[model samples]
Target chain A: MAALILAHHQTSPAERLKDAAAVAFIALLLGIPMIGLLTVDQGGALRIATRWPALFAFVAACFVGRLVLRYALDQWRARQLARDQADTPAKEVSLATNPLLNWIGWVALGVSVALPIVFAENRYVVDTATTVLIYVMLGWGLNVVVGLAGLLDLGYVAFYAVGAYTYGLLSTQFGWGFWSALPVAGAITASFGVLLGWPTLRLRGDYLAIVTLGFGEIIRIILVNWTELSGGPNGIASIPRPSFFGLPFKPPGDDPTFASFFGLEYATHQRIVFLYYLILVLALLTNLFVSRMRRLPIGRAWEAMREDEIACKAMGINARNVKLSAFAIGAMLGGFAGVFFAARQGFISPESFTFSESAIILAIVVLGGMGSQLGVVLASLVLVLLPELGRDFAEYRMLLFGAAMILIMIWKPGGILSHREPTLRYFANGGRR
Target chain B: MTAPAPLLSVEHLTMRFGGLLAIDDLSLDVAARKITGVIGPNGAGKTTFFNCLTGFYKPTIGSVRLNHPQRGVLRLEALASHQVARSAQVVRTFQNIRLFPQMTVLENLIVAQHNALQHASRFSLAGLLGLPAYRRAEAAAMAKAVGWLERLKLIEKADTPAGALPYGMQRRIEIARALCVDPLLLCLDEPAAGLNPRESAELNELLKHLSRDEGIAILLIEHDMSVVMNVSDHLCVLNYGRKIAEGTPAQIQKDPNVIKAYLGEEDADEMRADELRADEAIDQEAVR
Candidate 1:
């Protein structure tokens, strides 16, 4: 039925005008109150002023915009239809199964690896790329919970904050280095994940989302109020940077710095480059680990639970354990990202871990087809770079992001790449066994 | 009749939802390696009874004991839902098909054998490392899935998502998925609900084969009289959450209470009126 509509539906010029006029009508109704009328205070009394010309302009723009958008969409669809016919019936191929996507993934890896080297001196490029990688890593983590296990986790930033604070307190109070505190932070964050998951075990869908949102707020409030341990709202500064094994990337000193040990010139970009590579390796490892997990029994159980919890139970899968494991593993990965975040920034604050950060991380997971590993990378790039590039727009920066999100939702509601690859496959030649 | 030992014995099982009594004082014995058909009209508490047995609902006052060969008498009601399938090896399919819609048919079967593979995977450490033992376990699971898919004639559609298939095929896939658990007692709730005549016939053959050749006892809850009469070794009829009749197929068909329960009291009253008129005619003929 949908295919029939797609094949035959063509708008005449009059029909296009009608569609745009409808949009214009709605715009007039909405814009009259919101944009046309403005309240101005004159000597303690408010008087309403009408901007009829501005409203007319706004409505006209809406009409024209809708017509152009519709025309462009129709052209794109026509091209897609033509290409689809020319193609081999367009099989349902996922990113994991498609050879082209596989190659793209490999190329992406190559580009990421060569990026730091290609732009060794350009701090801004490497730094932005690193930021993108951080989101990619966080997206992959949240995917385990939201994508695979079907848990709506709104407080994921809580785990990230826990990890950051864990590293911050451990290093500042106990004088622990990044290497020593990384695993400890992860474990602490995982426990925090469990702490958050335990109560929400019976909850699902919107209720679960609400509870996790509260949990995120609770962690932030604690960090803000607790002055002794967390340094209150001031946060902990001077958090140590991760070293190259034992060699710190420092200026010339008695002790062997990374530059001195390598007999290279001391440069601050060395640390930035190291940080870039550190996150790069960390993100890659996270990808490898998560992808490997998808093929494992536990991972399959998570997916099964996500698909149907009642059926999972009937099939003898303990849903509680599956859900909790998803939370713990997801939190652990988020925690690892947090440790890197703290190390890279050399400062920690509750202000950095906010609800919007959680939303962005989640958006990356969702916008990149939920379970598609490569999707996360693509989405992170678009999400992070769009804002960076939109810096020129200043006030309209966020507006651009919102518009892109809305466009993606309209175009691909399931996701950019929604096909899921089977975790296991059978062959005609007595496969596996 | 010399019946085999009972595999699952329900002693006065009762279930109540709020003020409504769904199942009342229902006692039944499902024999080992035999198909026991539970037939009733809509809302006869047949599904409610299955829910009680499968640990979906806690029976208000009764014991559902599964006599496992190796594990002794296991109290199914005492165990959690998953444990009922895991340890007790008592698996069930839903009246409304509950196969994982997004998962492939093969993946659905593999998920059924999760416990065995999970244990072999050693907390996923072995699976992550792709160890030989875990690989072998996974291979075995795949082989088992393949075997069931082949048996159910779903091998060709193994890669297809379970939900995308036709309803009759989905029902078969659900049974095949349940079979992957290697269940000792398979409880099927309305397995033949949406089946056509040909499909129901195929289901009859499958149920017989399961009970006789595979030696897995089945507790079938079906509304299809042809299926229940054709394949069931013993039939138990339920009415208003109470057992109306229990016997072999032949006996169950002739049982008066069973007929009354099924066709309603009006039919039984009409049946009595016919008998009385026949008696009056016989008396007049004798006098002549």
Candidate 2:
């Protein structure tokens, strides 16, 4: 959906038509294979070809179509601007102040939150929404470091893994509850954050990124190799699910479970509703924390360091301390999300916390505007939910996903929303009572 | 006023970049509440001296002391740039304007006051939970930023990006940022390099007020002779990485070495002839 929006905003009628035609032609070419994949038996060569061919063909066509459309549009906009009267100054279209748009955006956000509760009958949709919320939390956490602090952290998932394992090991071994273990997990991950920051604080840009990537991989490797502690590839299972103050999410009898206590029927939809609300609270907490930090002195220091390290140093800001704090805080948020993930899934595996997971989180941050809380949430929702929604278009899903990201980036290099340039503003009346 | 101890005292400062001696045995004192101009021909180690004083470059040999009566003495030589700025109350502007380009004009001032901002709210978990104190501090910082912008006549362009301003306006913005730090000593490296006549005059007035009214000491490096002579309370001239002369502006102007360095004998004679013709033209204009 974001990709289609970007395509419409960025391309002219003629170029869009050309792209549409190319997509249609490729669809026709791959129609037979797609049909075979849907209808054929498992063990046939046709099935094998059908499984991969349409994906490959769709990817190739989208790649070619995007390049051609971009080139054509660039030429057209250049010509149109040039042909306009030279004496007339180009009109500056400012998007800074639009109260109506801002109100609408807030309203839309409220509706998105209330939708899951309203439509609790659909299990798949609720699950998808839950997944989107998790990504939103991850994106917000990464945004604090990457966007606000201007630190590129390729190893952010290491903290997430640490959080998961911390909760998983503590709760299972000690028979501790989820809420009790969550803080412990977060604190442990934050300690690792400071440890990671200790050596790498002085590094900047690409060097910092490389070091973080190594850190992420090291955490994953430790999980994989430490069989005694982590249970190796067999991952921890039967992890305890979160209950509302010791009430299990089952139907009540003489043993009062969550559903019976709440006077609800035994429906999976009730559990989904509970989880959705839990994740929503967590995501909101993450956003609230990051937004408040940004308004604080430490947050301002982080932004100052991002803008110019030398100037920051010259202004008496301890760059090392500022960076470490940013890392620790961002990691703490990641840890919180990780604890939530572990509790929500009742199972843990090294496969869940891979380098690819880190990449996807980072991609969400980039696709959203860096340093923008709202943009991160929106980007994560679109990126994570779209792939699930497009599952029926399975063979072409990832291809279209990649193409969409490229198109969005081309249209808005600063991300989908770039209006939030850092600033200091004063109220007209001094010191409001 | 009794001659107070130098606000900033440099003793035997020396810096070397490998084999090249950028600054050699350079020593100078910046008096309190006075403008001291460091003037020199090209490659006279003027900028290097500033760098060493500000802790940007650690000198191979030197002790730089800031004698603040209230704050006690500080050894600037061993501290990092940020530490020097905070403890010694010494702030500096770059030879080239280093305003945070993507930031707003107001944000640039607020960033300069970053350390001074209250962190009590930020330190507590309540801040992370969006306490009212954090919002109050932000509003205060913004208000202070606007005040500084208005003083520098940049209030109209307060919301515009810093990098989008014209060159002269940017230079003024840099000065405004430095002032926002409320430093005891301000080091300006060629602040008049790119200013037009009107802008230069405005800068001259600002510098005078900074010294006279604000009681802030200024250490200036300027290539423009008019600005240096017009504004400086005392002048220190450097040649070949050494102080050739130090005196009042009038005394330094008459010094033979200063004359010889700035103008060769042939050039001096030609300038003398031009001066005579300028005097005659002025007299004729006065008569008419």
Candidate 3:
């Protein structure tokens, strides 16, 4: 019986490996499209003709690679389990608990935080780090809904848009500074979240996904159509940049620019660095917030709802309230990220808040191991940063990314770093700081 | 005996699903600290009665008044299943085990205690930031879960997924989960249906312990005659959605209506002969 259970649980590893291989193969096959995009003539017909074989090859490679990887991983896991059992005569092995794992996790986090500060000095590197941080924050926020609550949300980017538009319109329309507009954006977005959640609380699974998808589309459509408010497709440009106590990012002089006030040159690197740290702080705050929530009773209730709605009801949990809170909280965090995004870009546009952006964020949460903060961050780093870092693979980049996501799902259906069970803890008594 | 005002009182509970009458004016009292057995042939509205009690299905015409200790008298008929659980403290176990398969045995119990264990800080940003109160509650819940596991003789399997447990063990865990709620009333549906003789005996002991020692009202729907006859302090027999008889175990055993309802007159003769043969075999086994 034990062997059977082990076999059943372990089958996923093999399946995942096969999926990963197939995805890699597909990337190779789709590499032709990237080549075509780069090499094809300006004429549309010529581009299509040149891209066909490359697309076919990419598809074939992905299929074959997936099959081979699956077979290999299955065989490997089986043998490893057998060997481990043989070597250790006793079946029971003492496993370390959460405290020790948490300690190690904190140390690893500290190292990750310090790495770029110590080694990366380039402005572009800093900019990339900041982008990864923004995604990390978004991933953590979405994790609360999709990971902890097990609700699949596809329009997460809408909240992001809400925050950006809130900050952008308020700052540009009135003379409100970045700091003042930030809270307004978050509040407005959270209210929108509640509005969206109210109508869709009864929906579950695929239905919820479709509604969220529609919600995202609606947000984008309204942003594009409402020229009076959003400045239309031309977007809100030349937005005010963030200031350090009324000092602008310019050379030190009577003008009180950032460079002159700080007694330094007005290098663009200064702005990038400041933005990087700002996003880093926001992302850290997101992680802290999600972590605390997971330990709270409401958090456990969310997990309970995710596991089984019927049983959750039997336990006296208000499913509607729990889901509403998740949606509201998730949207609030997305709004915070959006405000930061507006500040960082100094501009806003409907084009930035598309369905694909929502898909990518959802993919980050799914790949990271739903409900795992570290997993979300790691997934975001790989998904967001990897493509940018591998610009040479630009043509095949999106194809590779999509394939990688599919393979990851196949490999680790639960998530790459999902908790074995929903974390059940009460944060009401001042346990978390 | 003061009788405690009958924790759950039903009056003319009738439920109709389209043309088929699932339950017809079935009335029964679930007194405090008593084991009430509901027994009938298959599809005899046993589960439907449990559903009405738990607020899973609203009776077409009836009143289920639960005198709650904390939340004053509640009309269970108007409440949703979750509302009934929260307000009236009514908990139930399904016929087929419904444990979250991927969750651990400990998690199953913790989930059961979710309501009581929730803290106010759960809604705060501090709770979202992983506060110590949340950690302590988690620890307390785990400790309680371990205790429940020990009582169920499932301590060793605490870490194992609920779905990985044996069929009999899973049923026991389901009962244990319901116990975690510290419920005022527990309604179990066909708990003994799939258990073997030995497992059934264990279940009987547990059920007896719950009613006798815990001071909890237990209303169970079972088709297992031996279990129904042995453990019931009070027995209500139903046929075609109508109550045929209600009395003590001995009285229910001799009730001619019950015997006739369970077995038709023509089949009773054949069943009696078979019972006699079975009795002889038991005697022979005892002698051996």
Expressed as tens digits, the lDDT of each residue in A394-425 for candidate 2 is: 79999878888888887889986666645344
Scored on chain A only, each candidate's TM-score is 0.89, 0.81, 0.79
Better of 1 and 3 by lDDT: 1
Model 1: pairs clashing at backbone N, Cα or C within 3 Å: none
Best by lDDT: 1
In order, the Cα lDDT scores of the candidates are 0.90, 0.81, 0.80
What are the per-residue Cα lDDT tens digits for candidate 1 across A1-433? 1232233466778987888898899899999999999999999999999999999999999999888977876888889888888885666532235777789899999999999899987899999999999999999999999999999999899999999999998988889999889989989999998998899999999999999999999999999999998999999999999999999999999999999999999999999999999999999999999999999999999999988999999999998889999999999999999999998999999999999999999999899998889999999999999999999999999999999998897689988878788887664323433
As for DockQ, the candidate ahead, 1 or 3, is 1
Candidate maximizing DockQ:
1
Q: State the DockQ of every prediction.
A: 0.54, 0.47, 0.37
Error of 2 at A420 (Å): 1.4
User: How does residue A213 of candidate 1 score in lDDT?
Assistant: 95
Error of 3 at A344 (Å): 0.6
lDDT of model 2, residue B75: 90
Between prediction 2 and prediction 3, the one with superior lDDT is: 2
Task: State residue A83's C-alpha deviation in candidate 1, in Å.
Answer: 10
